[model samples]
Target: MPLTAQQLQAWSRQEAAAAQQVTTATQASIWLTLWAAFTGWYSRPQVSDLAARSVRILQPARQQTGGLGAAYVREVLAGLDAVREKAPAINLPAARLGADLEQVYSRPAEAYRLTYALTEDTAAATTAAQERLFTLVRDDLTVARRDGEMLQMRASGVTHYRRIVHPELSATGVCGLCLAAADRLYSVAELLPIHDRCKCTVAPDSDTADEAVSIDLDQLYEDAGGTDGAALKRVRYQVNEHGELGPVLGVEGQKFQRQGDAPKGDPIARARRELAALEPVLDSLESRAAAGEDVAGPLAYQRDRVAKLRAITA
Candidate 1:
């Protein structure tokens, strides 16, 4: 007999398999990195090269940058371990959403019973959830690395960290959130990434912080007072957590904040939320374009805008 929608939704076999993959894979990768860091540090000369020793012992810092730190390795490991525990919690909501969707679509469209995209959408959403879960894990690990390595620097008399975002195609010619704040040097613990997916590398900054610099500008502009003459290099539209384009009034040290009802933390999550909010408009625009209307130009422009917004997280 064919199972009813309720019966199908109640099935856990698929969910179990998917969840297990996300959980185990994340844990394995983290441990593997830790093992490599341990081996590298352990194999190095144990003499007075405390800085070199800190890199391997702290681990993630070595993975992020060839940097070192001390006294915080145990805490950082515990923090990274917590990412595994967070996986199931993240998966649960995705499971419920998938189940509800399957229930609705695994039924008859007319008198004759039918089934359609329900199963596929459910699976796709679950996979998306798993990918996002991994993103969170990576973000947490980045923050942990910064924390641990900062301790090592503090102990070794290293003073500052210069935030450097590894440039990629999407981020070309743009300063990400952390890099925006790199106008002046920061204390070892200070120059960490402001938010998730912010893989800005913080190397030991030799330049002193709070120093004055001079520059010549050809045009008059908003003169936000700072000793360093760090003027706006370029202007890119700022999108908040809700994915709405709003005023960024952004200076080097000021972090971006979402206005309106957008959920806080993780700009990418906000952008996703914004995209979801725009579905009706997107569908309409797409429909118009398909019907051979003039929406192609507008649709393309809107899509390009949204794509840039989405890439903020990337």
Candidate 2:
């Protein structure tokens, strides 16, 4: 009962779609957390109380969606069992199941920081930050929900898996880097590389690398016009390792800031740079305040932050 590549592709598409549904469920939970944040739920509480409350609100989402994801993985494995029943049933550890929950839950706080740092207009900044927060939560949860399936695939005697690119499934079509890697076998030990709203799926393979289905690499070159072309070269070599997202597709002149890569400079120097950047914002706020505009709250917050930065730099 050997499975054909087309058969794998079909399964991958269906599973990828189902994964999106799971992601949608995760997003609903995230929206509630975001609403709580915007409504000042986290602002008025003690840190310890906030932590406890956050866990209460987020834990159910984690458990419910995690259970669903694990069940989905088991169902997928059961289907693959018809072809080869070598995989053993195993449960994902509880710690691993909710590993990313804290990070996802902290996004609103991160957005709060970003809202202040980005713009002078509080309303506009808040809107932008909230939008970014939703996107980040959605993307990160997409990966988190699939963690159980990936872990099970590796543990279930799967030697390798194929990356199926479903560009048609997402509005943001698959990038060339993914396209280059698609339809090819990767070791199950490797984490699947993904980007924002990626709809790719990995199909477990019991076969050797040599027996794995192959993809035409030259087709990318053909699509890029020729082998010597810059576009083709970038497609082949611009792949980068992202600390948070695993492998990432890169174009020319692109840079990545990995997790914990921030706060790089000395504290005083960083503070000085921040103060320098905030000068124009402060001026704008001051002019608006003098014009009888009702920007006192934002003005005060900015002035206080500037004072703190100056004290540090001094």
Candidate 3:
């Protein structure tokens, strides 16, 4: 039987958890293959297959990691389904691009990268997939405005491309560039397309536009402020959990609080609370550093936490 919306959500959560486990296992297998290769115990194909399998397993997880935007899509679709159920006589547009929409909403970024990666050796398929994606976005998705290559949508949102191709793909520019553009227009928390060929343009709706803010990456780094730019870079890398990078910021709130002035009132208390939460992690990293052990991963996690804290404080 077809799953209802609630059932689908439940199933999706379960599937997401299971898929995450598989992805982790696959990552372990790849790491093992790397170790085997380093020890001269396996041929190239063995290690390659392990990595490939890991990518395959991680495909769904990576796609779903778009966070709240994916949830929004699911909710919107569910609402549509409810409407259909309540009023059978109500006419609704046939989902001619259902599969394409699913492909987009299910995992826009990874799907684009995966399709590109898989079909690198098959130019025709690559071209076809790209075309298919473009057509769906251009023809099917309700466009609110179009100015040159930039297209804004009423339903799905903004996309910019040199031209449209297929329902499932596009002939747009680099996916990362598209993502960067989307990130500028939408909140980082929002789902942004990450297809290599996606050049979608977007502007926030009237209600959302006031809240929409563009990120200046350089400005952010500048605002972090430190005498040593290299040190700042290292700190960022460490926070991201790069083993090669040394500890940038401690997990403890003490170091962070000392670096920045505390806000007034309850906000200061909240900041301190966050720092308290992070203290143990920071201490662990410090201990590891003193022992000359790699603490990149922990550092990265702490850095991310600190970044979030800073954002909240800001």
Candidate 4:
């Protein structure tokens, strides 16, 4: 039997609620570790040591989320009798977390160095360092766990997924970037591109789903009322390769610091570069669409990317 829109939405909420519990615990662990490090609890107090300690605190939380992720996907597949296979386990090696944490730790280290040189007060120096470390640690820890779950979900029987933007899940509400992506379906092979503190969860698409549920962006923009056409055009959804976290969602002008890239060129140049890379994909989609494949969603997305690229290059 095909699942109704309401049933799909209900499942999304249930999965999101379960994921939120783990997110809360992981964030709590980050805060507790940061508090202990800033205080005199750690005798050494090196930034490297702080990163190591934070990763250690988060290991159990990561494992829990991974397990939940596998179970969630397994249950979803089993419900549809899609496949009898088990969902793959998430393998977030400690070394990977440590490497990423080391980069985040650098911000606090630089803050402490600069502040101590200027202020000459140990208390002020430590406070500045703590303030810098707080956000980085929280965002990193949260995203890392989410990324691991996403990886597991992709390898599982989930072929397609849709974004669920529940404003109540986030205190700040949804951002325009996420709002722009709300109406589309994404393949599970793609990373659920996220910004820091993104509260959106994904609903797995059942082969027997009766309807594609999504937010109406046109109505949403109309309610806002002041954004002009140019402003609207700025909401280009493209994924950039992040140095630590693989593919991250960003708008047209946003630049990502790739792990081993030389200095990124100007925005137009980057757009051209991306367009060149996307050409083969667009060709493949066009071929598929012409053959009567139901590829309207993906084709529209690619066409939009090409249009945006041309606009930039112009």
Q: How high a TM-score does candidate 4 get?
A: 0.62
**Candidate ordering by lDDT (highest first):** 4, 2, 1, 3
Per-residue CA lDDT of model 3 for 137-215, tens digit only, reads 3222221111111211223343311111111122221222322232333332232232222223233232222222122
C-alpha lDDT score of every prediction, in listed order: 0.35, 0.56, 0.33, 0.60
Which residue runs does candidate 2 get wrong by more than 4 Å?
A: 32-104, 116-118, 206-234, 237-277, 283-300, 308-314
Judging by TM-score, tell me the better candidate of 2 and 3.
2
Better of 2 and 4 by TM-score: 2
TM-score for predicted model 3 compared with the true structure:
0.24
Listing every candidate in turn, what is its Cα RMSD in Å to the true structure after a full C-alpha superposition?
A: 22.7, 5.5, 22.2, 18.7
Error of 1 at 88 (Å): 33
For model 3 the local lDDT of residue 81 reads: 38
> Is candidate 1 or 4 superior in TM-score?
4
Model 1 agreement with the true structure over 67-126: per-residue lDDT tens digits: 222222222222323321111111111211122322221111110100101121323433
Candidate 4 residue 224 Cα shift, in angstroms, is 11
Weakest ten-residue segment in model 3 by summed lDDT:
143-152
What number of clashing residue pairs does each candidate have, in the order they appear?
3, 0, 27, 0
Runs of candidate 3 with Cα error greater than 4 angstroms are 1-42, 66-69, 72-204, 214-223, 226-314
* lDDT-superior candidate, 2 or 4: 4
TM-score of each: 0.34, 0.67, 0.24, 0.62
Q: Which stretches of candidate 4 lie over 4 Å from their true place?
A: 1-3, 33-45, 81-87, 93-107, 115-134, 141-155, 207-212, 215-234, 260-314
